[model samples]
Target: MYHEQHGAPAVAPLAGFTVGVTAARRADELGALLQRRGAAVLHAPALRIVPLADDGELLAATKELIDNPPDVVVATTAIGFRGWVEAADGWGFGEELLACLRGVELLARGPKVKGAIRAAGLTEEWSPTSESMAEVLDRLLDEGVADRRVALQLHGEPLPGFVEALRAGGAEVVVVPVYRWMPPEDLAPLDRLLDATVGRSLDAVTFTSAPAAASLFSRAEDRGMLPQLLDALAHDVLPACVGPVTALPLQAVGLDTVQP
Candidate 1:
């Protein structure tokens, strides 16, 4: 442990630094944490998590899946799984849906999905170490999906290739998109964040999810500021991510990110 030569008073490590938060869920909590550490937080949620626009289609699909339970069920995200179950319960088919899932071979993409399944009194028979959809699909393919009925809970975004792969394997795939991520209706805050980032005013930007980072980059592209934004992220400002999955897009583009 090293100490100052003159026994200087202690101070917040992040004092005078400004951090940008691009998280939707728990954005306030993150802001509070940074504030407490003496960082000025700039909050600009690039994406807003909204309920599916058309619940009728999802509910009907759930009912059909329950009526003729799929041979395999893939749980992608905890939020999507919980939303699907809760929606079924709202439509009075919760117990039936749970029973149907109980009879199927359950596969989770990650610990979150596994936990969600367990919370619903269901068991997960398989999950991948990477906790990625691609990994989950690979495992399913290796196990043989020919003539199997597979139900997948999507994480809002469309996975056309994944579905195509399953279909090519002779599996009937039913996709359940429980929620969709919509860009922030007001672009003013995001615009401010973009300007500040490029101007080197923000010390760091924290991203909790990949979609949020993508959304921000998409906006910057639309404004023709993507190059400057990337430069800032790569050189001037520190880019932090919650996990590797969330840092994938940033890293792919040659932007180094700090991740826990």
Candidate 2:
């Protein structure tokens, strides 16, 4: 299929598919893009966003970093680290956090994390070739973690195995939980989305983030709808992803994907 964009036609494979859009925010861009291609959209934002509250946890984490200043600061996501640092700034310790950053090498997970690290005014010592957590652990361990202090800003649901591996490598790992991804507090819309997908009413199901896909599946499974939902998404439903990273776990679960 081909698309005409800004007066120039684009040869695209996905010119007429009713793709899903699941980005956390600023979704209108992708949604509009898909609409122009003569495809219907389903806006089932599976992940809920919550800004940090009660600065105590962040303050504690920052003080711990400043006092001990981890040998490696592993940032998993750009948005998360920026939010963490901004909250730290609000606490009047922005410079102190930057001072602590200067004492340690930086390891970012993906380009997003790399951008966040640069946003913090630090240079990257290393980052994973892939955004996947497994790759990040492999690279950091290769470098050496023995008796080193490492701080991790968790992205979603905590990568325990990665944390466990670093701990096993004898690194004192401290964590900063900037945000969490969970099911919508109300299950009505999600419940409806699940039924629609399972019933083959949705034209496509696009996921911008893994947690959104995860949230849907988790809820469906709890309600005994996993197998059905998965089957529907695999066959009649289209699974579109914004990028390779967003496509990871969905592919892990056998969902065919169309990438933008």
Candidate 3:
């Protein structure tokens, strides 16, 4: 039973619950949302988003792609696409890059990626309903990528295997990494989150990206607490993700997840 105070409703649904947030870009916004629902928030950004401007390799890759446009271009993530465009603009090659992309057959992973491509004054020739990178590769392979030049705008993590798959299909693949995910500079916060998780002090953990989740798992493995952490998450702490893609890693470990 609960009682109201000062005309306010008693016991907000999330009262007495603690939720962990692992988003670097919008961590504060997510924390605020959880707080409004009466939950105590714990933020531990497992991975930090490094912009293309700061990554020399990524900048050079973008330049190479702009200089030599591929026959097909695959845009994976909205933020990654936006970052690539912004970086090229900063380098005084925005127009040239856009023009190059316009000449290529563009493929988007999903609506967000399609929106980013369209926003850049370019159009996507194809997009899959499943919105998965595997699906994107499958469609391209189905269309016969032999002897075609394909450029892929990589998201925050590496996709060497995906590149290999394309290469095996007889396509010359050029990977343009727009951004990357690095472990947080400060590991103290993440350590605390792991402690809480293992102690069953958290009610739920929210992951916005697959890399972040993978980073957390890697860190736990390093500390020899991977089994404990996984057990806690499975039995006590509810794991939540923003989408299926982010849930893939957790699902691989036979852990159930909640996602919108």
Which rank order by TM-score, best down to worst? 3, 1, 2
In every candidate, how many clashes are there?
0, 1, 0
Q: Write the per-residue lDDT of candidate 1 for residues 1-260, one digit (tens) a residue.
A: 12365677556778899999998889999999988878999999988877643566687788789888999999888888988888888888899999999899999988988999999988999888767788988989998999999998876555537889999999999987677678999989999999999999999999988788889999999999999999999998999999866887798799999987
Better of 2 and 3 by TM-score: 3
All models: lDDT? 0.87, 0.78, 0.88
What's the residue-level lDDT of 117 in candidate 3? 90
Which residue segments of model 2 deviate by more than 4 Å? 1-16, 54-59, 128-133, 251-260
Provide C-alpha RMSD values for all models, in order. Answer: 3.2, 3.8, 2.7
Worst 10 residues of 3 by lDDT: 154-163
1-260 in candidate 3: lDDT tens per residue?
Answer: 25689987587778899999988888999999889878999999998878677888787887788777799999989988988899989988899899999888999999989999989889999998877788888888899889999998887765536788889999999888777889999999999999999999999999998888899999999999999999998999999999877887898788999998
- Output the worst ten-in-a-row residue range by lDDT, candidate 1: 1-10
Best by TM-score: 3
**Candidate 1, pairs of clashing residues:** none
The TM-score obtained by model 3 is 0.90
Better of 1 and 2 by TM-score: 1
